[model samples]
Target: MTTAFITHHDCGLHNMGPEHPESPIRLLAIQKVLQKTGLIEQLKQMESVHVTPEQIQLAHANLHQKRLEMKQPDEGVVYADEDTALCPDSLHAASLAAGSSILATNQVLSDKVDNAFCAVRPPGHHAEHNAAMGFCFYNNVAIGAMHALQQPNVNRVAVVDFDVHHCNGTVDIFKDKPEVLVCSTFQHPYYPERYCDIQRDNIVNCPIEAHTRASVFREQLEKYWLPAIQNHKPDIIFISAGFDAHHEDPMADLNLTEEDYRWATQLLMDAARTTCGGRIVSVLEGGYNPVSLAFSVQAHLEVMAGY
Candidate 1:
């Protein structure tokens, strides 16, 4: 399927603290597992380029980049919100994270790759249009979707987020834009609870309760998300792929295993093949437990890589 694996070493430089769950070790673990399983050799690996300020503005406020720049710490970490933090290299890594999505979109749309997986982080689903929170800075998937809308022959796009937390930032940016379909399955009454209840034809929000089982999650997606995607008929599909919903994850309560992730990826792949020529640009969001996260990502990639 020619799956592109996009990432940057500098993404590991944006460390908040050793105790922080969103540590660089997350990517390291994924890489180790991919290598150990010989799966890394099956994909097209590429380094991420930096996102331009103008491209960052595609889904952010004009002053957003400047404000983050002003707040960048010289040495110690600075808190952007109660949970999100910025170190000296945080923005640098964030720019790459956002940039990787852009590159992935380009690769998929150009037919150079059937799909791409962005493994960069300071995950962006909770970043919002103007504010940064939930360990996210710039909304990576949003920027990529916006970029795709500007491309030739790309009339519409769908963003499907399966994160434990709602994609408030992605919904915030595309809520009013009908051409962009935003679908999400998240735990109800969760963190950064904004735009979850906002009624929009383009947004299909399936808010599952905490401790939701795997079968139920799949049932919800089949009932809610499938109809929306079929109706939207997007030119491309973007996944805010978060594995934090895994049962072993310390972040949230959901009984999803790596097999669930594989099943979900396969479902999305089928949808993309039907509606978008199998063009998907998936960006990493939240997945805290290194072991579980790595295995989950492996399953997702295996499906995308046609393994």
Candidate 2:
């Protein structure tokens, strides 16, 4: 079974600004590193499609999509909030980013692919049903998870997020849904600090602290994530994979490294193999620091490609 590499040039056009950590250069850096390191030879590369507004509405709201459609600027940049922004081409890139995951999910569910990675960005874990924040316009992972459940008769779906910042949008959108299970590990008392007390049973929030090392991250995976995944027995697995927790990233205080992402990928793949028909779809969420993001993404994709 081949692993799919889904991405597009449009993703690089959704630039936030020169100083923003979530810059368009982040995608360029990863693709360049992948090609330079010859990791592209190990996976099947495919072009991504633009997602429909209805599909975006599946994980978001009518007004949210409507507002985005109305607010799309035709010039330099359109600011949505403090962090998130919309370039003239941002809507195009964001559409393709979300669509890449949906296509990847279909490939995995149809048995055409074993696993897949989406190397597009302007990370989406922070976009909720009615709002866009944290440099995210649409909840890309949530759309992918919803696609998995709605298409191909997947009764249970699981989403795992390991961003240094909490995936508050993902949890908020999925907490009420019984068919979906969300497990997130983010820096406690970090950015977007609403998830201190989880209100749902299926939503597993592992809030770690500043300067946390790999051992602590892995321990939570064993104690919290693995147990919840074992009990849920998801039919398909989706990952909101974020590499900003790397020790080299300046965005947050976590001390994780590329090896930690590789290790977590192995564990998630193992769990997926056991109960989820070995189906996994991963979408990029957060990872700053171009060099560390490139290496960390390469490490994660190597594991996804069975390296």
Stretches of model 2 off by over 4 angstroms after superposition: none
Worst lDDT 10-window in candidate 2: 192-201
The CA lDDT of each predicted structure is: 0.95, 0.89
Candidate 1 lDDT tens digits, 223-288 = 999989999999999999999999999989889999999999999999998998999999999999
lDDT of 2 by residue, 1-307 (tens): 5899999987888877798788888888999999999999889999888888888988998889779868888887888998888888888889999999889988898889899999987789999889998899999999988877787668999999998888989988888998899999988888988665787889998988898777999999999999899899999999998999999998899989899999999999999999987899999999889999999999999999987
In candidate 2, the residue pairs with backbone N, CA or C atoms under 3 Å apart (3 or more residues apart, or in different chains) clash, namely: none
Q: Report lDDT (Cα) of residue 131, candidate 2.
A: 94
Best by TM-score: 1
Ten contiguous residues with the weakest lDDT in model 1:
187-196
What lDDT is reached at residue 300 by model 1?
100
For model 1, name the residue pairs that clash.
none
What TM-score would every model get versus the actual structure? 0.99, 0.98
Residue 38 deviation, candidate 2, in Å? Answer: 0.9
